[model samples]
Target: MWEATLPSSRHYQIFGYPRVQTPPPLNKRRVCLRFACPSDLQSRLTMRRRASLRTLLAACLAVHVGCYVVERGDTRVNNHVLREQNLVLEERAENSVHSLIKVTESTSTTIPAPQCVLPPGMAEEIQGYQEVVDRVIDYVTTGDFKGQVYSHLANLVDTFGPRMTGTGELEAAIDWMVEQSIAENLDNVHTEDVQVPHWVRNNESAWMTLPRLKQLHIMGLGSSVGTPPQGITADVLVVKSFDELKKQGLKAAGKIVVFNPTWESYGVTVQYRSQGASEAAKVGAVAALVVSITPFSIASPHTGQQYYSVENKIPVASVTLEDAAMMERMQARGQNITVKLIMGAKNYPDTISRNTVAEILGTHQPKETVLVSGHLDSWDVTQGAMDDGGGMMMSWAALVVMRKLNIRPRRTVRAVLWTGEEQGLHGGIEYFKRHQHDHEQFQLIMESDSGTFTPQGISFSGTPEATCIMEEVLKLFHRINATQLTNPMTGGPDIAVWEKLGVPTGERHLARGLYYSYLTNLLHILNELFFYVFLALHY
Candidate 1:
């Protein structure tokens, strides 16, 4: 946690720099400065017996290196020019705050101006299709699907329970979607083969063996290694973070690392579940157990995919928050915690799966494409009703509404029901590999991996031009209160690969809904999603 601090703006002037806070008091230590500085100031910079850090700062201030100000107090402000020159604030030695902040100059602009460089008349161009967008909303809300869309989703999830990747059930679900696409008479209704990993979680169990024995609720993470038939019985070393594990160091050796990270949003905390095993194994830990990645939890464990390094593979699973906290308390009280975990999880060779694709050929630019897709795969824990079932239905419904309403788009509107998303986006990756040769043809890519119930609009990532166009397109959804647009770090993992190649990507955002809940705030959501998808084709 090093801080590069500088004097406050009130006391010192940094020419063109932003305001910054004063650095904390530095220890009075004898040190010599041998850094690049003005020749006149360099002579005054020398080792003085018991010289304070203040003297050094005053010397650097005299030079006023450049007009470009770096707010040292704000570490978040990146000056790439300094980085490119290998300039850094290097601490002289251990236990010494004595350091130097090297700032240099480059002719190019250090910081880009904050401006939305939209193409001229882009908004007006998108507004031209307002009438068509209205028709899409009307058709999905009152025409064919209106009240029956939710029922269709309910039937799909209810009929095909958990559609785990590489499972026959998932393949069956894919077949059903293909049949439905054909039944709807969508052109190019076909399936592309995707080879996906097969990780099976057969009967697994875990229980406490020390500090009062009790059965522990657990779910093995995807692709986790299975314990031997006799199982792994070892003392548990509870840690709240990877930093704590590093502090404990060798204490984790031959132990089961239990992670009980405090809730800090799913994006921040889920890392413990995904990479805790490898991190634990790095310290010679035999296995890792992470608290379920959720803000609120019943006495149930959650499961997600975990990646293991080739050299540091270890068994990993999720324990309920209750159990993780219980272990945390036991360890804090100087009680030795021990647990026995036995999992029958196995990873087989990658097998063939299919990504269902259906398209409405364009009326004008037939070769150009606007793809909307969602994963058909789910974790084996329960029926993935809300995980992505709604997304799948909505993407499919986009094609359905366009077909039923006889709205042929200028660019091809393709709906892909991706498989093996839970196993780390195998379907989407395969799609990218197969279509990358014609990458320019794809104008926009979107996915709804986030729960689709309680719709709020979409999060997007794109060039300023693309973002401006998307914002205008979203205006068409304002009637349903779903026109909000946000720029996120990413849209979603499935469509994320294409975003790298400068293709605009959008991820539908929802305000609420649990992944396991079967009850969805339907009908209205269908209005948003169906309208969201169908209208995107107009781009």
Candidate 2:
């Protein structure tokens, strides 16, 4: 009923298409395949004069797969022929073998392949942690460390404006955290040395030249290359999305391609900032300009990391919403829009950075760890407060609260403030390399790199059993109304290293897409309280 083919590396040609019985010479062997049907059916399988069968059926697969060597004409290609009983999708046919039969020098004809492929009913084991969860919620909400997250974060922001990776100020911030961890009587406070990228931004500017001499507001994407000494002045080629750029790629050569994607979720829209430059350069674009990633902008341009395609590393930066929109409008009116981009950004040799580690040793299982982390480094635009500051301080505050209450989990609760997470996962990767051999001891790896927005639940990936246990733990947070576990389908970059190594991982799933506003509104009471519950649930 359907047609499928095996790989060329095999020595068989199976086909169900153009089904017909073809006559063969007596000199060659013709196998008569008679089906025991309601009526009767027959098929002729022609073989060579020597019609010798050769195939490693055991080498293919053991169980139900019916390995066959069917040669059509002189073609020795490998193909899969459908069985007479039922029709199956070609893709799913190879995985599931319904019948166990093979075609040898004898008469036999049968092939079958079959393919094999949710949430919170809280377990009783998790039901036992109710008392401990309640105490954690109370301590974070109304106890001694009630409002200290803000004060601590404020001091961190005021002390170090932007803790970008490979910077002196960032190292000082790590040192301060180390001293503070030791001051809190947390045991085994130290740092893990790692190398991180260093890209400095200075004198970055953009100006509209062809349409008018209007200055444009711009922010260079992290790791973007700087324009030459004289700057890059070229006509602007505006495109709404990557698709449009691809359609009109011929017009992009030697021009500055501008991406002005409409307001969508950050996950959908930030592609321009992350990959616009490399994509544009592929089409011969001399440089790329992306409209700020924010859905709503008050004349401010947002900047994030942009990776370069080694073949053509071009300059890339973000322009304010107002300017990018205006440029698009001018282009629609058939006006020739041109702009000059000047970036003094420079990349230095990789420098050393430290991941600050402070732990509260467990009372029973000291070797096993419930690891909580947040990136300490940030983009060099502002004080880097909300993006990760809130997450980092919240992580540190959890450790501080447990220490203050003289409480410890069954496993070691370790708070790791990772460095160089913004540029890439430099510090996190190095830390993983150092402790990958000890993956078994890592009971859980948790990170909240996203803004500590109104807590919905945990973003997690693990076995079904693990998911059931975590859902039961989430139910314990019903009092605070922040208990829903969802998978971060597209996100979870920070802890990707451990997730691949089969370690159980969790990231805070916030009500994202309001990052531009959430950064300024730092007094989120629920966001702060949910963190404590998250920490306790993992233990």
TM-scores of all candidate predictions against the true structure: 0.77, 0.75
TM-score (C-alpha, index-matched) for candidate 2: 0.75
For each candidate, the alpha-carbon lDDT, in order, equals: 0.68, 0.68
Q: Across residues 244-279, which tens digit of lDDT does each residue of candidate 2 receive?
A: 899898999999999997644454456689899999
Count of backbone clashes, every candidate in sequence: 0, 6
Please state the error at residue 346 of candidate 1 in Å.
1.4
Per-residue error for 423 in candidate 1, Å, reads 0.8
Q: Residue 265 in model 1: shift from native, Å?
A: 1.9
Residue-wise lDDT of candidate 1 within 48-155, one digit each (tens)?
A: 322222332222221213222223432212222222121222222322312223322211112211244456876676777878888877776766668555776777
Residue 179 of model 1 has an lDDT of 88
| Pairs with backbone N, CA or C atoms under 3 Å apart (clashes), candidate 2 | 5-79, 6-78, 6-79, 96-113, 96-114, 97-114
